[model samples]
Target: MSLLTRLLERNLRNSGAGARRLYSNHAEEESSATKHEFADEEPVQPPRHQKMATDQDWSAVWPGPRTFQPSVVPLPLRQGYTEKGAPPPSKFANAELMKIPNFLHLTPPAIRQQCEALKKFCTPWPKGLETLENCEKRFPIEIKSTDYCHALPTIRNPEARRVTLNIKLSDLKFDAHAKDKFLRLVGDRYNPNTGILTIVADRCPLRKQNYDYAMYLLTACYHESFVTESWESSKSEADMEYYSFERNKSKQSAEAIINWGQPVEEAKKLNADHGFAQSVEQLINEGENVYNLGKYKEEVLKLLNISK
Candidate 1:
């Protein structure tokens, strides 16, 4: 080979050798640095749960709500579905367990501790409100509402805004006219079987606003029921909703029949019997039922002294 060609080949070989040695040195330095860095650190200990005693205070460890962590909880809890008859996935690295809310903080001991801490803020029960009947009598109005908690962006629930007010119709002080008007105004809202009037208000956005709206509706209905319209005075016996013995012609007919063969003083003394009036009213109002007919016959016989 020529001298220039030989020299060029030697220089190429030297450069290639130098590049290979530089790469090898870099790789060895990196490996040694990594080993030294790790060796300076202590070895990772086992999970905290492995060292925990059986009687450790769980409340102190998990004081409030949190996501499930397998390393923290010592229990051998398992979750998730598997095919081929395989057992459920263990708690370690479990996505299913972490997705759900954990009640680990609400252990019996934790609940007792919380209750004991809150005991100083509570008051004793009132003396007279022992029985449910007594409570109802003292506080007739009952208000109902609901609260919700879930994993959501917003804490407020739309259904929680609804407020319900329940009160017995009998609890209100109503005269005959006011009671009739109240029943007519409330319609199906008032239950005849239980005498409970339920008012549900949900138009407002907040619970307190809805509660106030319900109370306003009740107050308006009550006051409106007591108002006497001018046209109500013109309601004649023919326009009456139910049969009334005192307001009907049956009262006059019975009185005339009872006073037929008696003197003025004796006729005055023989007013229509209260029982006879009630029976006649029931017989007419309840139609020709067998019970009503039987009661009417008994009352008539008693009134005329024919059973003697």
Candidate 2:
């Protein structure tokens, strides 16, 4: 071989060896970098509930209202419906559990603690208003309203705006004419059995407004009841709401039969038969029911001194 060709071959061999060495070093560096990256990475942690102690204060952990967290709660709660054979969905990553309200903070012990804390701000009951009867006497008017909490965009409930006012008719001082007029004005709103006049007001949008409206209605009815119209005086016995024996022709007939051929003073005394008057009034007013009719028959026989 020529000297120049030999020299070129030797140089090519040296370059090939250097290239192999550089490639080996680069591969070793890449492998070491990959190993270091893996060593620096953190391991995945277990759930928070697994780390929590069994006797831990749950109220402190879940203080106040919040969306449910599966990892934070210790209980194995499950929700959401599944197929007939399948079990309900687990608490982990459950949309059903997260969507609804959680009462975790309102545990019995927590409630007792809260109530104790609030006791200092409360006032003792008034001395005379201990009994329900005394309370009703002291506060004749009873106002009722409702409050609601919902997971809705708007907190205002339409039904909550309605206000109800209840008061016994007897609580108000009313004469015969005024009482009758008040009953007529209230119609069926006044329960005869309970004697409770219920005034429900929902015409206004706000609760306060509805409450004011109900009070206004009650006051208006009360004042209007005492006002005697000219037409009311003209109401004859036949036009009376209830039968009154004294105001009916039956009174005169009974007096005539009882005091036949007697003097005026004797007739007046004989006319004062309370049993006969009561029987007549009841039979007419109560629509002649079997019991009332029997009572009337007995009273009539007694009044006329006739045997059954």
Candidate 3:
């Protein structure tokens, strides 16, 4: 073979290798540029809360009490403890804040809207139940309720077993003796100021049992109050827990003073003064006070027709 021919072949092979290397470099550059362009054209996802507009209705986002949601809320809130001088972590992806309950769904407008929506399922107010007095007269019994929240496996509150029953003492018909007996039987559960009887029964573990027990207690007291035991009739005025001037020397003395040296008819007329008798009794039992003395003096003057 000729040397020149061999050298030309070597040169041709070297040029081809150089061309391939140049082509490979150009293709790699083109591929890298295409990737950069595609990356620039891709859509950017902004923070979820940033999408919320100022004019957006919060009621639509949350309609009731629920777990806290950070993404949907537009507020720039932060939570979790930090160093003394450091700010708290941002609300986004904040486990400490999200784990707690939120009142976002309980906004005034949301509550109003929820109530309006629920109104369609409610019944109209009953007739003749206009005033609170009228309602109380119709339904004197009041039942109490309670709610509880827990972070346990089961949602049970021990206090939920407690049941309260209240009713006006006036609602139950009773004579003076029966009423006194009922008051004594109920002990401190009866409120003299409000004339209400409050019965609380927590002896049972279940609420229904406790409620039933309270009802039984009330019924038993009412029935037992009317029973006239032989010992009850034998009780004298001195044996009474409280003072009663009616069966004492005070009533007779007061009547005698008001009807002094008068005939039977006049005495009967004077004795018929119930207001005077009541005022005199109250004054005697309650002891001396300016108001009581004034009231007693007024009653005595009215009964005897004396001018001061």
Work out the TM-score per prediction. Answer: 0.74, 0.77, 0.72
Residues forming the 10-long window of minimal summed lDDT in candidate 2: 263-272
Cα error, residue 159 of model 2, in Å, equals 2.8
**Which pairs clash in the backbone of model 1?**
none
lDDT of every model, 2 decimals: 0.90, 0.90, 0.83
Clash counts for all predictions: 0, 0, 0
Q: Is candidate 1 or candidate 2 better by TM-score?
A: 2
Name the TM-score of candidate 3. Answer: 0.72
How well is each residue in 1-308 modelled by candidate 1, as lDDT tens digits?
Answer: 69999999999999999999999999999999999999899988999999999999999999999999899999999988899889889999899899877789999999999999999999999999999999999999999999987657676889999999999998999987888888888889999899999999999899999999999989999999999989889999888887877778888888777778777685365677888888987887779898999999998888777863
lDDT of 2: 0.90
Report the C-alpha displacement of residue 270, candidate 1, in angstroms.
5.9
Write one digit per residue (lDDT tens) for candidate 3, span 1-308.
Answer: 69999999999999999999999999999999999999889697886678888777888777667767777778888888999998889987798777766667778888788889999999999999999999999998887857677555566788888999999999999987888899999999998899889998888988989989888999999999999999978887878766555667777887778678778784354553677767766776788899989998887788778998
